[model samples]
Target: MSYLFDHPDKVMPFFWEHVRLTFTSLLIALCIALPLGFVIAKYRKLQAPVTSVLGIIYTIPSMALYAALIPYTGLGKTTAMIGLVAYAQMILVRNVVAAIQGIDPMMIEAAKGMGMSKRQIVFRIEVPLAVPVVLAGIRVATVSIISIGTVAAWIGAGGLGRLIYQGLNHDHTGKIVAGTVTIALLAIGADLLFRIVEKIFSPRTA
Candidate 1:
């Protein structure tokens, strides 16, 4: 607390860095997961195998993933981003698949009967109805990423984790506490924001 209030200039940049890393990686993850989820939902045979694979990838320790990527990405934001995206896949993909599947079959049938094209049905009916579930997954991922993103600093990605690491090395408990508290607040803020958005997107009652 003292460290944060005393050194706003030092702490704020790292806080923003963490935010940027989390949001950018999440955007990339959503782009990859959505289409993949669509395909998995469209093809029943692919669902089990593909999700199982993603689950395995997600289960790999974050540090291990970072270490593995270092050879290829050479450490930095790109490596951190890639690791975060990979970690997000299972949650996003599974929720997207489930959301799409949960869309009432009768609703789809009615859309088709109304002469709506497949694309139109997907965009107008399926995706809209699935928004709440997708947002829920995103909320979960965002909070997790905010917390884990601190590790990115170890790989030179430059986040609040850097402060924590420096604090640990220098035996500065105030810095460590400041960094930890900031991240917790970030995650909580993100979760609350997403919940609000989810409600806005959720299907309303008659």
Candidate 2:
């Protein structure tokens, strides 16, 4: 609390560090999930198998995942990023599949009747209609990634987790509180921002 205000110089860097770690992993995850999700949505047969694998990955604990990767990746940001991306796959992919699947078949048929090509239909009709739901998934992924990212510091990845670990190491309550509050604020802020985005693109709004 007081530590945050009193030492903005020190705290701010870690804050941004955490932000970078979280968003970078999220971007990579999104890139992977979006294409995979589209493919799964297009092919119903692949959905169950792909989802099962991601579900298994998601179930693994963050720390455990980091440790498991340490031997190969040798720790630091790569290991953390890999773990973060893996954990996010199920949530992001599931949401993406649901968002695309939830669209009206009649709408797709209408687009086809109008002589729209598959690519045109996907980009022009499906994507616009699917944005809100995809954003919903992104919101969940953002909050989750932010929370899990703190653990990255344990493996030398560097984030707000360093503060908490440092506090525990040195018996400093202020650092712990500062880290906790900062993370909570980040999660809450992200949720609110996504809610706004969701509302903006909502079908009801249209």
Candidate 3:
């Protein structure tokens, strides 16, 4: 309590860095995951193989992933972002595939019977219907990214994790607590924001 009150300035910047890394990684992951997910889902044959590979990627130990990336990407945001994006693939892909799969078959048939093109059906019906599940995946991915972003500090990627590492090195309990608290707050805040967005986009309840 005293530490938090006493070191507000020291803590805020690191917290902001954690937020920045989280959002950046999420954005990049979405860019890759959305299209890839759609592609894999649309092509039934590819679904199993692609998602299986992504799942494998997701399971790689974060520290090991970062260590492997550091050789080429060096120590910084790039390496961290790469690891974060890789981690996001399994969650985002699964959610996306599930969302698309969950859409009613009759609706798709109706669209086809109505002479709707593939693009039209996908954009007009599938995506809108799938948004809720997709958003849920985004929420999960965002939280995962925030948690993993802490590990990035080991490789010199700046974030609240730096504070944790610094605190350990210098035996500063205040910094450690501050960093951990800030990250927990960040995850909670992001989850709430996405929940609001999800509700707004969701169909009105009966």
Candidate 4:
């Protein structure tokens, strides 16, 4: 409490860094996942292999991944962001594939029967239908990123985790509490935000 109360200037910056890191990683993951998911989902045959590889990547421990990346990317933000992005891939891509694949085949057939081109069908029918499920995946991935972002501080990526590790090193209970509490709140905030979004898109709500 004292650490946070007395050091708002200090703690707040880290809080925002954590936010930035999380958003950046998710954005990157989404950009990559969205297209790749669509491609693999379209082919159908590609889905199993691509997702399997991503699943394996996600299973590796974050620390090991970071350690492996550090050699190539060096320490600091690059290494951290790469690691975060990699960990996020399995969740984002799988969700995207699931989202697109979950759409009713009849809806697609109707779109085609209406003389809709592939581009039109994709943009009009597929994208809208996929958004809610993708949002759910984003909600899950966001929390995962927030949790992983803490470990990122160890690599100098700079986030709330800095306070945590630093506190451990210095035996400062206040720093640990501040970091942990803020992280929990951030995760909760993301979850709720996406939940509202999911509800908005849901047919049930309409």
The whole-model lDDT of each prediction reads 0.93, 0.93, 0.92, 0.92
Q: Candidate 1: count the clashes.
A: 0
Candidate 1 residue runs with Cα over 4 Å from true position: none
Error of 4 at 14 (Å): 0.5
In the range 1-206, model 3's lDDT, one tens digit per residue, is 45667988888888888888999999999999999888888898999899889988988999999888888999999999999999999999899989998899999999999999999999999999999999999999999999999999999888999999999999988888888888898899999999999998897878
Q: lDDT score, residue 52, model 1?
A: 89
Can you write out model 4's per-residue Cα lDDT over 30-148, one digit (the tens) per residue?
Answer: 88988998898889999889888999999999999998888889989889889888888899888888999899999999999999999999999999999999999999999999999
Q: What lDDT is reached at residue 180 by model 1?
A: 93
For candidate 1, the per-residue lDDT at 174 reads 94
Q: How many residue pairs clash in each candidate?
A: 0, 0, 0, 0
User: What's the lDDT for candidate 3?
Assistant: 0.92
RMSD of candidate 1 to the truth, in angstroms, is: 0.8
Q: Per-residue lDDT tens digits of candidate 1, residues 1-206?
A: 89999999999999999999999999999999999998999998999899889989988888998999999899899999999998889999999999999999999999999999999998999999998999999999999888778888999999999999999999999999999999998999999999999999988899
Error in Å for residue 179 of model 3:
0.6
The ten-residue window of minimal lDDT in model 2 covers: 197-206
lDDT of 2 by residue, 12-89 (tens): 888899999989999999999999999999999999999999999999999888989999999799999999999999
By summed lDDT, the worst window of 10 consecutive residues in model 1 runs over 143-152
